[model samples]
Target: MSETAARAGWVEITCEGELREVVGGPNRHAAHKTRTALHALDRAWLAHSPLCFIATSDGDGSCDVSPKGDPPGFVKVLDDTTLAIPDRPGNKRVDGFTNILRNPRVGLAFLLPGRGDTLRVNGRARIVRQAPFLDGMTVRGHRPALALVVEVEEVFHHCAKAFLRSGTWDPDTWAPQALPSRARIAKALDRPDDTLEFLEEYYGPGYAERLYG
Candidate 1:
């Protein structure tokens, strides 16, 4: 230990709450949040976004972030302040969806490839299965297992730094081809071929026609 530096109190934390916006440069005028800024169902954002990440945590604070991707507008805007996202088939852990059952607090980050700005939605969610909503979506004639209904708390657009840092829009930065395919992934799990192939194919086209139609 550096006794001299420790005695000087160099590592001091004020622990004060503050809003810092250093990256966007100094604001001559502070812009307070407005209804326009806090959009519920902005068609433009949904139209551009084909992917989003959903973050949820359980009562114990254990967390899961699931990557959700489909055609643009796959997430249906039920009203000015609510969104209906179909619970598509997957590996069946249902971690994120289940977490929301215990704790409604959730964070959604909507992403559009090749675009700089992205939509961020923070909200509380509830699971629902009903007539209009249930009838609104289907998968290969089969209906959605369930749907997550999100009550918008706050919504905003963030700059491109996240995409730039992740190189999400760059084809060269993509994951290597040797990464496991669904068939290969399923093989590793020892699941049957019929189920795996159906799921693999269902993930894209099946998903589009199912939810977006």
Candidate 2:
């Protein structure tokens, strides 16, 4: 078969009607759960959340999703319609931040350990390098150099079906050793020039000491 002919065997739904026909529409409560500003319950959830994933896309629609995490309550609730997430030490790629500069729209999903549900927020984001709030975001005497402030446009509580189906919080379902260790993978793919022994040492127990440095 020709390449185009072979691809014709796959069926794709390109319109809302076709897509909805397959999955069905959400019920009234599911369809109307979104809120434009944070509620008291939402604030409580954010206070207890230690991690979240931020999703962004550049002007050209190129995308990136990055994870941000810290001790519980790391994300600050600035107001009913605003939130601030501290930027911590990481690989320095800043792919999401770059995308935010090009396109302010962003989405976030906040997760709590052992919880099946998540809090979702969609908003406009701006990168702030200097702010009085940055001082209060400090941890272990290390203050963040920047933060991403989000003006919440929509916020909602997502259902836990995805997590429940995946057994995410079930300890018995975990198999972390099913894959190679971080050091071994880094040596194999990212740092081919470095010796395996060196990479292992670099990602060893002492690695935690450099987390704030």
Candidate 3:
């Protein structure tokens, strides 16, 4: 490459002397102050999803990625711009919840297992300990650790490309064996007691009871 082109900040060299393109991606869509996208969680979408990704970040830039899952429809759609969900019992790290306290920004992506498409929601959130929905929710005859109230900003239909490329829904490409054993994963997480055996012993019954009832 010419010295003139190399002098531009768009190119750089790594410690291994590998030349790299620093930044050359087309710009994304402009942010709309008032979103025209769908702002509601449809019952069908929430009813079919088995997992959701939650992203939250503190004011200081400390971020947390959390995975939420259950039978289905744990998230309740209140209206076109609102949703609620009871936070079930767990390890109690509360990283996502705490981040919401100091920062209102929150993002959610819901995926239906074996389905290519997903739902995405961006919004501000707050911890809601007492809500009408929480009134009847009980796990093992105990109330949820907490409930989350999300005020929707924008909701969009996420394409299936990521899932297709990752073979997320393809049973033939599934690698249940490649995953670490439950006990080993818990050990690496510094919670040897967090065995699947233990979680199953506790959550399995509670999840079924609360979900069905």
Candidate 4:
């Protein structure tokens, strides 16, 4: 490695004491984590959450996070201890699923529009491709080929300090702009072959029909 790169690495925090010195520890309540199969409040929160981000780590310690969103209640409560999230069609990278296969531990954060607080779920997860499970998650006649079965290990509600400071749920705080076309994004990457029309057609209103297995 270059001298600068090697010198940069030497400045990294090597232990908790060094890290805590730079950034102080959390408050007492912040350190207290809630653990439950599923509380009633958690069930209600999950029922209305249409978006969630899940983080997982591979066996070799590599990490990946994937966003999953569908209609409200897309993630079903199988029981107090379990949750079922349909694997919707996407770019098919499957990073989250692949990570779960190697390391079952996952951290999930569910968000509902207009709500400042978020629901957090941490658990062990497994990918299920059984017909029965897949068929149950069918949307518009499109059944998912796979679903994630998450066994709840810890469930809690995260406070809205970050959202409150950022005004995430406030429309007035948002800047007016249209969604960026994939062509524009491709151009930024020096790829000229991706067309705006193709991206528009692929992600337009009718794109909902393609969200099946």
Per-model root-mean-square deviation over C-alphas? 6.6, 1.4, 7.3, 3.2
Which candidate's lDDT is highest? 2
Lowest summed lDDT across 10 adjacent residues in model 3 is found at: 30-39
**Candidate 3: stretches off by over 4 Å:** 1-41, 136-142, 192-213
Taking the tens digit of each residue's C-alpha lDDT, what string does model 2 give over 57-141?
9999999999999999999999999999999999999999999999999999999998999999999999999999999999988
What TM-score would every model get versus the actual structure? Answer: 0.69, 0.96, 0.71, 0.84
Model 3 residue 140 CA deviation (Å) reads 6.0
Residues 1-213, model 3: lDDT tens digits: 998878777644664435324444334642333353444345579867767889999989899989887657777777777877678766678999889889999999988877787788899898887777876556446666577878888777766888889987788987887987655666667675676777555545465555424
lDDT of each: 0.75, 0.96, 0.74, 0.86
35-154, model 1: which lDDT tens digit per residue?
Answer: 323453456788668788999999899999999876677788877778778777666898997898899999988877798777878889998866487666664565776888888887
For candidate 4, write residues 1-213 as lDDT tens digits: 988977984777899999999999988887886877888888899889999999999999999988999889899899999999998778878988889999999999999999889999999999988846666677878788888999999888899999999998888888655655555665556456757677667657777666663
Runs in model 2 deviating more than 4 A are 1-8
Q: What ordering of candidates by TM-score runs from best to worst? A: 2, 4, 3, 1
Would you list the clashing residue pairs of candidate 3?
none
The residue pairs that clash in candidate 4, if any, are none
